[model samples]
Target: MRKITAGVFISLDGVVEAPDQWHFPYFSDEMGAAVDATLGAADTVLFGRKTYDSFAGAWPEREAAGEEDAGFAKKLGDARKIVVSTRKLEFTWRNSEQLQGDFVEAVTALKNEPGGNIALSGSISVVRQLLAAGLLDELQLLVHPIAVRKGMRLFDEGDTAVPLRLLSSETFQTGVLNLIYAPAEPAADAGYEDAKAHLPQS
Candidate 1:
């Protein structure tokens, strides 16, 4: 089965929105390599509507301009992209498809298909939904040092608590924390609240 891995850039305060505002200052060769490695591992890419629109608008233009990361842009342009949307969308990006129907069911079916893995980036709502549905296999958070006090947090208020187990962690010279986690199995004797309480905070 194909694994569904989510890669997100988040602030120290858990804010995942508008990473462009604060994410670049800390970008380094190491960070670039990490991103390259993540992309290399995935054969397919999944996106929420907003992320799809943003990427389709920028990557194609970057590829056309022959930018510094033109190779990366080309890879993104060529990869099979599955955009989750309820309404019909004009997908001008190459190798892209729209997924409509029950969100969890579609994603579950995708996960069961034969593929390397499905990589998800910058799709907050989609990530939350997948986590809640127990469809996410791995979560990789690039935690920056700065905190943007006001923005959409990764785990917002009233969201259901999902337990996770830390699989690995790395600290970069730029102080970016690359934390990897997997969904934790609920203990046989533990209640939902107990299981959540034992999980680490992101």
Candidate 2:
């Protein structure tokens, strides 16, 4: 079974939306290499409707222009793209498909199929759903130093706290932190009981 991994660029304040406005200052060869490695590891790309539309608008043009990262853009263009959307939209990108069914069920089926890992990028709502459904296997956050202060955050208010175990972390020269995490297993009953005992009685 392939693992479903989400790779996102976030600010110190947890803002994940519109990283392009602030992320470039922190870009470096190391960070670029890391992005390439992550993309290289995935045979499939997943996106929500908004993200799908955004990428479809931009990456194809970049690929055509032979811009820097054009090779990576080609890789993305060639990969199997599954967009979770109910609204009808023409998919002109090669190998792109629309997924209008139950998100968890559809993604679960994809995970069970034999293939390389799946990569998810720039879909906060979809990522939240995946986390809520316990469908995400790993999360990679490229944390930048600056705080955007006002934007859509990765974890919004009223969101449940999902336990995560740190798999690894690396710091780039540009002050970008690559933090990798996996969902932590549920605590044992005894361990939970022990922690509960320390809480104040009402």
Candidate 3:
């Protein structure tokens, strides 16, 4: 089975939208280095349509400046990109295939396919689905301190994003806090007062 990793830049309130407005300035050397490090290690990429559009516009041109991450960009351009979507899109990026069937089924099949690790970026909707289905293996959450009163979210399911257990956390030089999490099992008697009252003896 393949390991699926998600790299996200989010806010304290779970906001993962438009970090470019206040964070992730790829022009800086520090940010460049971080991207190089992350991209250099990953062999496969998974993303939602929104992220696919963003990358399709930017990454193709990133190598023009001759940065160290340029090679990674080229690799990204060539690597297999699995795009999860319902609506039809005319994306023409090389080495990409669309996943249009059942969400959970498609991802599970991908994970079972013989391949290296997969990395997801800016696919908040897809992340929500993965979390709902318990398919996410790891999360690289770049948590920024600023609060955006409104925007997209990291893992907001239609009803609610499932609870997560913070496995580890670290601070970057840019003050972006990275929080790692694994899906936590829900309480047996959750949301039921009567059930909680009759909980098993410890």
lDDT of candidate 1 over 1-202, digit per residue (tens): 8888899999999999989889999999888887777765678999999999999989999999996988889989878999988789887899999986899888888988887878999899889889989899999999999989989999977745677999999899999998989999764575788779778899
Q: What is the clash count of model 1?
A: 0
lDDT of 1 at 25: 92
Q: Order the numbered candidates by TM-score, best leading.
A: 1, 2, 3
* Superposition error at 150 for model 1 (Å): 0.7
- Name model 1 segments beyond 4 Å from true: 186-202
Candidate 2 vs candidate 3, TM-score winner: 2
Cα lDDT computed for each candidate against the true fold: 0.88, 0.88, 0.75
TM-score of each: 0.89, 0.89, 0.80
Question: The CA-based lDDT of model 1 is what?
Answer: 0.88
2 or 3, greater by lDDT: 2
TM-score of 2: 0.89
Q: Candidate 3, after superposition: displacement of residue 105 in Å?
A: 1.3
